[model samples]
Target chain A: EADIYQTPRYLVIGTGKKITLECSQTMGHDKMYWYQQDPGMELHLIHYSYGVNSTEKGDLSSESTVSRIRTEHFPLTLESARPSHTSQYLCASSGTRSSNYGYTFGSGTRLTVV
Target chain B: AQTVTQSQPEMSVQEAETVTLSCTYDTSESDYYLFWYKQPPSRQMILVIRQEAYKQQNATENRFSVNFQKAAKSFSLKISDSQLGDAAMYFCALRQGAQKLVFGQGTRLTINP
Candidate 1:
């Protein structure tokens, strides 16, 4: 069983449509991250949150936006989806600095824009 | 800034044999952690092993072990008696204190029957 869950395991939308990718963790981790990965490639961090109401853009620049209203929930939204937005989005959560479990990742969401 | 690098894009090993995947990272921080994660076709990222930067002893788990050289900034994963199930895309990640995790370009491992 997965402690972290991402809804809409797969999504396809028309260009210019707005979509929200939902990620929730049951572990109550203080750190949550959203990573964008292309097929057969590396993961690029697009957004991250240290705690509630604290979100920051990652090393990779993305048009998407994220929010951390609660400790367990971090959702990424694209105001206008485009063909370039097609890729897999992975959600991960981790404990505090002292915790050594690393990051627990969700199965990931495959997004396609037509 | 932190960066992880996996030199090999793909590696193949015969069943029951051993294979090693190489990873190197660049980081200025002394207090950090390293991890190896495996992602199968299902796309679920599974934690394979972890190593703390301060630990001198290498970390091992069952058929998997990591050669963590803090001085060299290299962390390699060695899989003993490789099984068909072991075939997957393996990623090397690094995380500094209270910082986001950095991932390398994954290496696809193939287990030959």
Candidate 2:
């Protein structure tokens, strides 16, 4: 089973409120990623990190920011939530070895900005 | 940059039967990787199978197998003995080396019992 975890399985917050989505892994993966998806829609990459202190923006432009201070934790923060930001956020992690290249994804957080 | 495409928006098959889901990708890099992931109603991305670009042998995982045509740039998933548990949104993903994964729109698979 995948060891990655994401907190706040579901969230509902008011507009303009700041929110943070937490993601962690116990498998000691060096690469982590965040993807946003509408219900039953395509998943768009938002943010990714190579390792601690390394972060990069993905194909999709996201207002949220992510930090990887530790190898296990990669948290995404939204400065001001909006109704448009309401979507499911998925976190995934992969190891450095070729044998472990496939991603192990988290259950994902469903956010609703009202 | 690489792009993954799933032409079928949705597909269905009867239980105990077989079905195929089409996936095609475009990439300039010679060395890359292709993957198929299944997302159930719970919305967790599950890696079903993976195929390396350099490998000529198709990757297979029990009931799940892939038809990888490198020259055609097509990677299709074939599920033998379709099960209800297989009903989900299937995504085709591409990754080159250590870069981030790129996913296709996804195909929703349904199993009729």
Candidate 3:
């Protein structure tokens, strides 16, 4: 079955630790996105990509950065994690946001910085 | 930029009953799309249904349906014959033409015994 995957369902780390959140999809979608959400809040888009090697910052400015070296993979990284960076990171891909189908999301990575 | 709003912080429905969760949005563009996504306790965001701006008829999936009042900028979800599995957080999302989606604060649905 085609699906999106994220690694380390939950993570807890100390401040200043380098962390990477992995995201991959079996579907050959060209558009991929990264979103951050606090508990019970609206998800905020932090980064997005149109295709391989193409990435753009999203509506919400984020300290983390993302890279799209392959169509199926988009990874987000924090050079130095902080308590303020603790949140749920969600990965999604879509054919087109304008299309009726909308986006397919992963289970997400819940990070806690202590 | 588009914005979505889900006024109800939470809602409850008895098994086999029906419940509706309200959603509203603000957008300058005339053409857009609306979606209802379900996030279960497992934390997977699943698409429940979608509606196109050009379509006058509302969208439905099994026990799930939408009441889309485009002129009023309101899109609400109606779940019929609610089951325990229907208990989840539902998010209302809006997309303008071909951009990233704007999501509302979710509405947590609790199915009571």
Candidate 4:
């Protein structure tokens, strides 16, 4: 089945540790996005990519970085994790054709920095 | 930048009852798209329904329907015959052209037995 996937559904790491959250999609969509969400709060777009070798920062200021080397992969990395970095990270993708279908989101990764 | 607003932070409905979740948005563009997403405790975002800006008809999916007032920029979701499975966090989102989705603060819907 064609769908988006996110690895390490839950993570716990010490402060200052480097971590990466993996996200991949089989839908063959060109646009991918990463969002950070806190409990009972709205989602904040951290990063997005139009296609391979294309990436941009979203409205929210994020310390994390993302790369889109392949059409299917869009991974997010935190060079130095902190307690405040704990949050649920969601991955989503959409085609360029229409916004009517909306973005297909992955299950998401819940990271807790100790 | 387009912004989505969910005025109700939380709402509840008894089983088999109906409830409406309110949502409003701000945008300068005329053409766009609106969506309602459900996020359960499992934390997966699921698309409930969508409406096109140019369409006069409101969007509906089974027991789920939307009341869209384009002129007022208000989009509300109504759930009829609410079930326990309907308990989840609902988010209103907006998208214009090829831009990324802007999500609302979300309304936590609780289905009381």
Candidate 5:
């Protein structure tokens, strides 16, 4: 298994609450990604980081923001949680530079806002 | 943007039989990468196989192999002697260089007893 780890495997929070999804990797990979996937569906790239202090939004329009402070950790935060934010968040890391360098994905955090 | 298409929404095969999942991608770039990922009920995305566009020879790993046709823009996976463990949702994805991946909606594979 990849050394990538994501905290809060599942989250259920009230609307208007602030939330942070934590992702970490011990492999010292230069690339990190966050994907949002609904139940049994395609994975949508929400955010990605090339390295520390560099983050970019993916093709999908996402309200969440991400920061890459340290090489090992990339955390995503939401200002205010909403029902539209409810979905499975997957954190992944790639060790190599190949376009298809097979991302090592976490078990994922299934979030439900009510 | 590169786009991947998996025409089959669902597929099934008897245990010990062979099954194939189809995938096609659209890309103007000559160099790129292709991948097939297996997501079980656990929801962890596991890479089943990959093929580089530069390579003409197909890539194979154990019972899993990819039929990559760069000219035709097709990449498919064939599973031989399918097992119960092979049941999962399969995603076909495309990537340009070392960038983000574009994935298909996925195909659910069932291994019938």
Candidate 6:
């Protein structure tokens, strides 16, 4: 079935290490988003892309950046990861007419920066 | 700007019983959409139900249903026949036009057997 996927479900790294979280969706949706969520807390949008080559920062300030190189792929990168950057990263995609169905989300990547 | 709120941080219900999760939002736009998403432990978040602001009728999916009071800026989820699988984090979300979706603090639902 067509669904969104996130790689490296759990990751632990030393502080200052550079890393990239992979996100891909096979649903051919035009809108993709990245959200940061602390355990048992509300999710906050960090980045979003309307389509290929289009990206924008979200409401919450984030040190990470994202790029939409392809319709199905939206990856987030951190130049130097910090303990504060550690959290669950969720990827979601929505179709052009998403009012009816809303968004489809990936399992999420839990990163731990020590 | 829009804001979504889930007053209840957590809720509990007995198996095979019914429970309601409250949600309220503030938006100036008349035309918009409301949705309830469920995130199970270590699992992906999935849309449980959606409601269009213009639709007067409530939205329902199987044992999941929504009580939408557009005028009052309220949208609540009602789960019937609660199951163990229903125990999860439930989030209320809102989207207006091309704006980004806003999410409320999730309510963790616990189903007691």
- Name the top DockQ candidate: 4
Q: Which segments of model 2 are wrong by more than 4 Å? A: A98-100
TM-score of each: 0.95, 0.96, 0.95, 0.98, 0.94, 0.97
For model 6, residues A57-80, the per-residue Cα lDDT tens digits are: 998999999999899999999999
Which residue pairs overlap in candidate 2's backbone?
A: none
Candidate 4: residue pairs that collide: none
Model 6 lDDT tens row, B4-38: 99999999999999999999999999999999999
Model 1 chain B worst lDDT run, 10 consecutive residues: B94-103
lDDT of each: 0.93, 0.93, 0.92, 0.94, 0.89, 0.94
How well does each candidate reproduce the native contacts, as fnat? 0.69, 0.69, 0.84, 0.81, 0.75, 0.78
Model 2, B41-64: lDDT tens per residue?
A: 877788999999999999999999
Per-residue CA lDDT of model 4 for B69-94, tens digit only, reads: 99999999999999999999999999
**What docking tier does model 1 reach?**
medium
Q: Which parts of model 3 have CA positions greater than 4 angstroms off?
A: A96-98
Q: Per-residue alpha-carbon lDDT of model 5 for A3-22, expressed as tens digits?
A: 88888898999999999999
- Model 5, C-alpha of B85: deviation from truth (Å): 1.1
In model 5, the Cα lDDT at residue A5 comes to 86
lDDT of 4 by residue, A1-114 (tens): 999999999999999999999999998899999999987668988899999999999878999999999999999999999999999999999987645689999999999999
The superposed Cα distance between candidate 3 and the true structure at residue A55, in angstroms, equals: 1.4
Q: What is the lDDT of residue B68 in candidate 2?
A: 99
TM-score of each candidate's B chain against the true B chain = 0.98, 0.98, 0.97, 0.98, 0.97, 0.99
A-chain TM-score of every model? 0.95, 0.94, 0.95, 0.96, 0.93, 0.97
